[model samples]
Target: MSELDDPVGSSLHGPHAALARRVGRTATYPADVATFCAVPADPAPQDWADLARLVGPGGLADLFTAPGTPPPDWTPEFAMPGRQLVAPVPTGDVDPRVVELGRDDDPAMLQLATATRPGPFFARTARLGTFLGVRDGGELLAMAGQRLHPGGWVEISAVCTAERARGQGLAAVLVAAQVARTAADGGRAFLHVVDTNAGARALYARLGFTQRRPVLFRGFRVPG
Candidate 1:
C-alpha cells in the first residue's frame, strides 16, 4: 500500500497534517484552513497551536472526548482522547431506510439528539448540508449530516441514535447514505470520533473505513 494508504501513517495522523504536507505549506487563517482539504498538507505546528487556542480549552477538551459532546457518561468507553475517526464511504448498496432532513426538521432532530445528547456540533452541522436521519414510525432515531471543508471534503457528523433504538444499525445506515451523497457530489466523507469507542470504530471498519488520524484542539484564552 502507498504511504497514504497506511492507516497508521496517514489516516491516523488527522487531515490537518495531510493537508499541510499536500500543500507544502501551512494555512495562515481560518479561511485558508479550508484550502487544506482541496490540497492536503502537514499543518504547520504553530498553526495547529493557533487552532487549539481558537477553540478554547473547554471546547477543545469537549471535542476530544466523544462523537457527541455532552450528557457526560452517555457512552462511557467512547470518551474523546485527542483522536477522531475519518472513514471513507462506499456508495453502492445503500440502505433505503435513510432519508435526508432539512432545517425545518431541526425540532425533531434536536429532540432525538437531546435525549442522546451528542454534542453542540450537531446544531452547527445542520447549517452545512443535508442532514440525514433514520425514522421509526415518524420518530427520528439516528442521524448524521455534512460539514463542508473548503468544498473538497464533507465532514460526516452528528451521528447519534436514540438509546431505545440502539443495535438496529440506524447509525450505520445514515452514515452510508450521507457518504454516498458526499461522494456523488465529488467530495470525500470524513468525520471525528473519540479514540476509544471500539463499537463505533468497528462499524466504520466494517464499512471499509480505515482510521485516518487523531485530532486534538486546545482552547484560546481570552485576555483579562
Candidate 2:
C-alpha cells in the first residue's frame, strides 16, 4: 500500500478535511480535493491564486501548506510553512506542577483558551486529541495540545499562558513536557505561529526549535 494508504496518515487527513468542510474550505492533494464548508462563501480571487502558488505548479504531494508560506525542507512537494514550535521538556521527569488536561468540558480550560485569538480552534482540536497544562496553586497558567498527526508527526498547538503569568518560563516548561512525551512515544513534534509574533518565536527558539517555514491563514466570510 502507498504511504497515503497508511491508517495513521489517512485518519489525520480525514479529520482535517472534515473540519475544513464544516467551515466551507477545500484542500487539494495530488490525487483529489478535500472540500470543507468551512471555506469562505466569497473567497477572494487572490486567495485561490495564493493557494496555487504555495502548492506549486505541479500540485501537492502528501502534505498541506497555507498560501504565501514555504514548505518545510523535510516535507515533499506540498510544504506547510511556519516553523513547528518544538522545545525540550525538562529532562529526567515531567514536572509535578504540570498536568494533562483530559477534556474541554472543563470550564476553566475553555475560559483560559478563550482569551487568545487562536484559542477557540485550539480548544476544538484538543477535544479531538490531547491537551497539557501547567498551574500555580489552583490557577491554570500555561498549556499546549496535540494536532494533525500524520505518520509519526504530531503538531504541538494551543500553547498559551495567562497574561499576568508572563516571564515565569511557564510556557517553556509546558512545551518541554509535551515534547518529551511526544519523543517518548516515538513521534516528531511541529506547530504553527503567526510569523509576526517575534517574542513567541524567540521563546520557542530558546527551547531548541528552529524556523521550519512561514504559513498564512486568510479567513473569509461564509455566505449565508
Candidate 3:
C-alpha cells in the first residue's frame, strides 16, 4: 500500500534510482527524462524545500500523486482527477507484430509521442524500461511501455496510437504486450488515467484492468 501511496517516490528509490536527482528525501528525474518529482508520503515543510531545491527555481514539480501541499510561494500548475488501474497476470503471448524499441528509434518514438500526446516523453525516456511498439513499415502506429517501478508493480504508460492507426486495435495489442511482459518479469501491472478520459478507462476495463484507487495528477511551479 505504501508503494502505491507514493508511487513516484518509491520508484525513485527503487528500480529507477539511477535516474533520480535528490535533495534530502525529495527526488526527481532530469527534466528531459521526466517531469515527475517525488516527495515523502507524509511530506513535511522541509521536504518541500528539498524538492524546490532539487527542481530549481521556476521549474515544474510534477509530483505524480505524492502526498503533501507545496508552500504558499509555489504556484499551482495543473491538477487532474485520475484513477489507478491494476491488471491481472496476462495469459497470452506477445504479438509478433510488436517490436522492442531502442536508441536508434528515438526520433521516431519522440515524433509519435509528440503527435499523440501520450504523456511526458523525451529523448532518453526509453531508458526507463522496455518499450514495445507497433510499426507500419517505416511509421510507428502505436506504443506502450513500462514507466514507474514501485515495489513489485510496474506502471504501463505512454500508450498511444496514431490517428491513422486508431480503430485498428493497435492500442489494445500494445497494452496486452506490456501486461504480458510485466508478468514475465514477476511484477504486477498498473496504470493511471485522467478521469475525463472515459474512453481510455473503458478500454482498460476491457483489457481486464480494475480500478485500484483514485489519484490526483498534480503539479506546481517552484518558487523563484
Tens digit of per-residue lDDT, candidate 2, span 23-43: 113343322222111112244
Error of 1 at 213 (Å): 2.0
Residue range 126-195, candidate 3, lDDT tens digits: 7788899998898888899889999999999989989888988888989999999888888888999999
Q: Which numbered prediction scores highest in lDDT against the true structure?
A: 3
- Report per-prediction Cα RMSD to one decimal: 9.0, 9.7, 1.1
Of the candidates numbered 2 and 3, which has the greater TM-score value?
3
Decide which is better by lDDT, 1 or 3: 3
Candidate 3 to native Cα RMSD, angstroms: 1.1
Q: lDDT tens string, model 1, 130-152?
A: 78888878788889876434335
Q: Rate the local accuracy (lDDT) of all candidates.
A: 0.54, 0.54, 0.88
How many clashing residue pairs appear in each of the predictions shown?
Answer: 26, 18, 0
Ranked candidates, highest TM-score first: 3, 2, 1
Q: Name the lDDT value of residue 182 in candidate 1.
A: 75
- For TM-score, the strongest prediction is 3
